[model samples]
Target: MGTGANCVQSPYHVTGSTWQTTSTHFRKQHTPHSLMFVCFSVGWVQGSTDFGVGFNLALDYGLASVYLENGTTVDIAKVEGGQVYKAAMRLNDNNIGMINGRTTYSRSEQINFKQSFLDNYIYSPNRLGGDGNGNNARSRALSLMLKALKTATESYLDSKISNAEVVVPFPASESYLHDLRQAVASVSLHMPMSAQPPTGIIAARAHGMYGKCFDDLDLQGHDKSMKNDPEQLILTIDYSRAALTALLVDEECGVFENRRVIHDTRLGLNGLHQLGSITATDLLETALRNITQLPLDDGNGAGLKYISNLVIIGESAGDPRLHDTLRRVLSEQLEPVTTVKSGFSPPIDPVFAASRGVAWDCWDRMNFQVNE
Candidate 1:
């Protein structure tokens, strides 16, 4: 299962749903597996929307659709819905859309819903080692999120998952990542838990970026361009409401290389949403400068000089208002550079793109393990 600021995704086995492997190399059929990728989303700001990918997945495959929760499913196009930093969940038998937003709650419920936006349980210096009441709610909320996914997954699989691996966004700190891992373990759903990778040292963007570079035609074109010209670079932006991650991609002797994951705290998604247009524009300008000016060695004496493609992703990137603002600001900044061939483009299904990419990454890893 993968949860993002905008959506929760699982590889669900939709009964009678047909799927096409992007790569023809995989067309030689295997023992059919029941799971297909699905996404559930909610509005980020207002916390008032809920939808799923089941109906569209079924419709796309010309299969009969089945409702798993509350009979709500969405058009595949709606995966690009502009919402960020909010997770969708079922609470008190009713669906909760804005898990991240602040709302009034009973003293008991406050703790659980208070830190709902982030998977990391906020801890103070005093509560670090002691299991405090304040920590329980956040922990429980995380568990509940996992429990919900497990229930849906098991229902679709018709069996319990013995070992479940969750791919979480690479967090800011190691301790926070450890806390996130522990939260999943505490759920005790009888599935051994694992996270994508350790925190801070890597970027969650890597999984999606690698997945895209693996097959996505547009991204593949960038790779081919890089192979022909070593100086060519691809800029990938992971634009989530919580944070913005930037990566530089290149091809070294026909092999795709993710050069580095750039970190800039000043470019956080919450900061962008909270700031006025002028301030946000300024922040974006600074971010663009930071992105284009990354000090990466491309083996040539000249460092990165040309960006062939720019892939914008994440739920926030899909927001027309935000997208326009950032694009306008970025265009203003890039006009002087004059090297990047393609300008900013809104991500294709920004919400599910990352989750689907992550799913592909997991599938590859699992296949590797099986072959090994």
Candidate 2:
């Protein structure tokens, strides 16, 4: 049910017809060829403190990525012998068996229960654990995935994991957030509990603003004039499954101060038959107009603030055709007044943006104790 060249049912030890769980240490007992995974714990030494981790696990994307950071270095952990993890997991009755990236359970009926946790989440929210989800199997799967992430992280890093700041791709249900925290604890991993929960993708985008990736070279159509401005409005486009959302944010000096969702619609996704990516481009144009016309810091519409940077993110945000179209369209719309500098550089922007951004956020907060 997996795609890797070595994909197979996960391996579990058998003790005279009885099943016994295995640990990461079990990998060293066999040669690399005989083993289904890489022995990540081989040469590394454990560190003094737990690590700061950022988890970008949007089940809709069908995969998860963990960005674990120490003080100076960041490790994109290798789970199931890969950096990106499959969202698939094997189930045993109502119990979660070996997860895709962590360990594998070699059982005949593993495929019978092989399922995507996120897919289950959509159809039956409760069965995945808490909030009427009885067995907590879904939450257990999540916790095991977290364990896979942490073990994978520790495999490369020298430190143990403290916890992670789970970045919700969008505003999820209260039960969803509740299960997220609960899942963290189930693995002995920690996520600081608080009255306020992690924000939507907006917060991820905002935190991304402070990452080193925001260097001038990565900024498209960056204007020298706007460089000195104390505050600038930013228009961020988050596209997924062809659906797109335009967000407006106030960047005060280097800080993201105020934000608003200007447009949320599936107009962008309706472009399957449209000519030359017209529908998606039009929706973006509408979003741009909405952001530029909004009231500035004073809440007065008398003074309009245009967007300085136009950033696009998501799994499918890497379409070269879309990139060319957006650049050309945005340039046409705002060239004379202000260049909407784009942050839509392919593969990297869409894939690593959220994980890396939130990792930096986790790192900073761990070091400085900032309010989340």
**Candidate 1 positional error at 58, Å:** 26
Q: How high is the lDDT of residue 282 in model 2?
A: 65
lDDT: worst 10-residue window of model 2 = 33-42
By how many angstroms RMSD does model 1 differ from the true structure? 14.8
Residue-wise C-alpha lDDT for candidate 2, range 225-258, written one tens digit per residue: 3444344555555555433444444544343432
**What's the lDDT for residue 86 in model 1?**
23
If scored against the real structure, what TM-score would every candidate get? 0.49, 0.52
- Model 1, residue 218: C-alpha shift (Å): 24
lDDT of 1 by residue, 1-372 (tens): 322122222232111112222320011122121222222222221221121122111000111112222433211222211111122111111111111121111000111334445433343323444254234443444555455555554465465432333433221222222333455566543221122221111122322222222335556545554323333455556555455555444533223333444433345565566779778778766655555553445555656555545566555556555456446545633323321122214322444443333333333333333344
Model 1: ten consecutive residues of lowest lDDT = 55-64
lDDT score of residue 292 within candidate 1: 56
Prediction-by-prediction clash tally:
2, 6
Which runs of model 2 end up more than 4 angstroms from their true locations? 1-51, 59-141, 194-229, 240-245, 254-258, 262-301, 332-350, 369-372
Of the candidates shown, which would achieve the greatest lDDT relative to the real structure?
A: 2
